[model samples]
Target: MDSIRFENVSKSFGKTKIINNLNLSIEKGERLILLGPSGCGKSTILRMISGLETITTGNLYLNGKLANDVDSGDRDIAMVFQNYALYPHMTIEENVGYGLRIHKEKKDVIRQRVKEAIDILNLTGLEGRYPKELSGGQRQRVALARAIVKRSDFFLLDEPLSNLDAQLRGQARKELVRIHEMYGQTFIYVTHDQIEAMTVGQRIALLNGGDLQMLDTPHNVYHRPANIFVAKFIGSPSMNILTVKMDGRDLVLGGQRVELPEMWQKKIHEKEGRGLKMGIRPENVVFSREKGPYSVKVNIHYVENYGNRVGFYTEIDGEELISIMPEDEFAKGEDVYWNILPEKLHFFDGETTMSIGYPAELS
Candidate 1:
């Protein structure tokens, strides 16, 4: 059974629609990331699942039970917000076990659960310390400890690591994976951070303008994006997109015929005389001193060195493209010959702005 399911779910505030007919099913024990830019309704989805926001339409099922009308406290779920909401007046132990106290659980049970959570969070000696005495990272861990002691199988984390520095966030992210493995629980992480979503989530649901853009494995969503929005949003440097016109079996970009894989020939013939969008990642682009077929002359505008490699932003036939490669002897305004991997080409329909899947092999 699906752990969480949203069937035609929609949320609105007055006349403004926040989520428009979202349909998704999250499996138990899965780490799913709701990723999108701000105001995309990702956070609203989390709020609805937590019972903090009322669903305007359709149903939300939790573990095969209708959860639209369920009380947040009775749902057996724990949430960690972006801000560490630890009580400043209480010790770490007291803060971690506060929920048990609220539920009026036995003192002995609370003590044992608090100890386990402390051990898991590596807060052996710091248990006596208050939130005001701890660092930001430590305070963040205290929030997690509170959730951990709750012993809920479902976790809702809303950018819980966003407040930490880069190094601390990296460390916390690894710990979160370890904790999830140890507990074997379902994690619903909401974030606009692409790095966190790419590394932490097994499946990613991308939202845009209150609409579900794409939902799939991280690899598929990265490599086989559903549309232009997804194609651009997930990548770090983003994919290089060029508007092209179909020239018989060739793709004419910038009024020049661009070399592409043979597999696209049949597809292009079927879509003859149509305008399409061509996508290629920066890493797939290669530069060589020796020029051959498919090589285009480009004027390098800027080169950014990242220690291990370099990024070359160049213009070719009026189309700007980015190519990341090893440190090479190239200067600004220099003419360079570059080529893109044929197999890595991404084709999209211009009108609908959706991916046009080319067959793997034509028999």
Candidate 2:
């Protein structure tokens, strides 16, 4: 049985629907990332699963049992919120064991569980420190320890690393995976940050405007996006898109005709006269001054230098395209030649914004 399941679920606030006709299943021992921007209902979905928010329609199941009417406390989930939610007056051990104490567990059992949690989280020596006395990262670990001590059925973390510094956040991301590995419970993490979703999740459920855009392995979502929103959202600089027309198997773009990938040539005949958008990741656009088989001349409009690599926003055919290179080689207004990697091109139906296909192997 699935760990958690939502069938045709919808949530609302009076007149506004926050989550619309959603259907999702989270597997046992699987780490799923609920990813989207602010106000996208990702958090609401988490809350609903925890039984803190009511499901307006459809069914919610926890461990193959109906859970729509279940109380939050009875859900057997350990959630770490963005703010850590630690008590200022309690020491680390006290905070960690508070939940067990509330359940009337024996003092000895609570102490053992709390010790195991704190030790696993590297808080072994700092058990005596209060939440206010520890550093931000230390306190974040404390929040994790508190949840860990519960040994709950599911672990729900809602942007728990948001408050950490960049370096510490990166460290905590690895730490979270370690914690998950140690516990091996069903994990659902909600975050607006794409990096967290990509790095930590075994699978990603990308949502937007209360709609589930796609749910798949991270590689598939990144390389073979279902639609334009996902293609644009998952990448660092976002994929560069150009609307093109299929001229009897040749792609017509920017008043220039370029040969489509061989895999597309066979598919193009049936799609003639169809308006399509060709997407290319910034990393796949090779920048050089030399002409190539499929080349485009562009004027650099913006240069973003990130020490090890450089990003250029260029204008071509009235559309802004992004390209990244390892070293600084071009300047603003400097005309340059760049070629799109044939196999990396993604074709999208113009009207539907859904992927037509990418260059793929035919069985």
Candidate 3:
């Protein structure tokens, strides 16, 4: 049975919908990330699971039991919030052990559990320091430690590392994975950061404007997005999308024509004369000095140095595209040859903005 299942779940506040027909299943001991932009209902989904927010319609099941009416405190779920919801007056030790104490645990047991959580979170030295005395990252860890001590079957985090610096956030991500492995609990983490979703999640449930966009393993989500929204949302520089018309065995992008590979020609032959959108990741756009079979000449309008890699920005007709290359080989205003492999190409239906399926090899 699934640890948590949302059966056509939806949420609304004062007639304003926040979550729309979300059907999802989270396996026991799986780390699932709810990822999307702000106001996309990722956090709202987390809250619904935690019973902090009520479902407007449909059912929620926890461990195969309907949980629509379960009390938040009776759910046996521990959550870490984005704000590091720590008590200002309580020391780190007190805050970490407060939950256990409230449950009527013996003092000795609370002490031992608090110590273990503190040590795991690297908060041993600051046990007596209050939340106000701690750094943002430290407080965030303390909040996590509090949830860890609960040893609940379900663990939820709402952007718990958003307050930390980049380096600290990276470290915290590793720590979270380690903690999850140790406990083997069902973890539902909500974040707008794609890096966190890509690295921490066993599977990602991406949302957009209250609708579930895609739910799949990170690799598949990155490589085989469900629609145009997902394809543009997951990548760092975002995929380059252009309108193209299928002409016989060629795809016409503005005035430029690209002869489709023999295999792709057979696959999309039915789409001939139809309008479609072509997508390619910036990293997949190869730079070459010599012309290839699929090569196109483009003048670099701008160049951005990203330390390890460089970004070459150019326009084909009126549409802008970015290409990431390892080294800075061409200067701004220089005309360069670029090509995309057949396997790297993504096609979307023009009218619906949904994927038109990949080549046979990738299908």
Best by TM-score: 3
Q: RMSD per prediction, one decimal?
A: 1.7, 1.5, 1.3
**What is the lDDT, from 0 to 100, of the residue 259 in candidate 2?**
79
Residues 1-363 of candidate 1 have per-residue lDDT tens digits of 689999999999999999999999999999999999999998999999899999999999999999999999888899999997889899999999999999999999999999998888888899999899999999999999999888886899999999999999999999898888888678899999999999999999999999999999999998999999999998878998888777665666655676566688777666554568888888888876778677666778999998988999986566789998887678888887876566788888888888887657721
Candidate 2, superposed: residue stretches over 4 Å from native: 269-274
**In candidate 3, residue 183 scores what lDDT?**
95
What range of 10 consecutive residues in model 2 has the weakest lDDT sum? 354-363
Candidate 2 vs. true structure, TM-score: 0.96
**TM-scores, all models, native as reference:** 0.96, 0.96, 0.97
| Candidate 2 lDDT over residue span 160-246, tens digit each | 999999999999999899989988999999999999999999999999999999999998999889999999999888999988787
Checking candidate 3 for backbone clashes, the offending pairs are: none
**Model 3 lDDT-worst window of ten:** 266-275
**lDDT at 254 for candidate 3?**
51
Clashes of 1: 0
Alpha-carbon deviation at 312 in model 2, angstroms: 2.3
Q: Per-residue lDDT for 217 in model 2?
A: 91
- Candidate 1 achieves a global lDDT of 0.87
lDDT of 3 at 140: 89
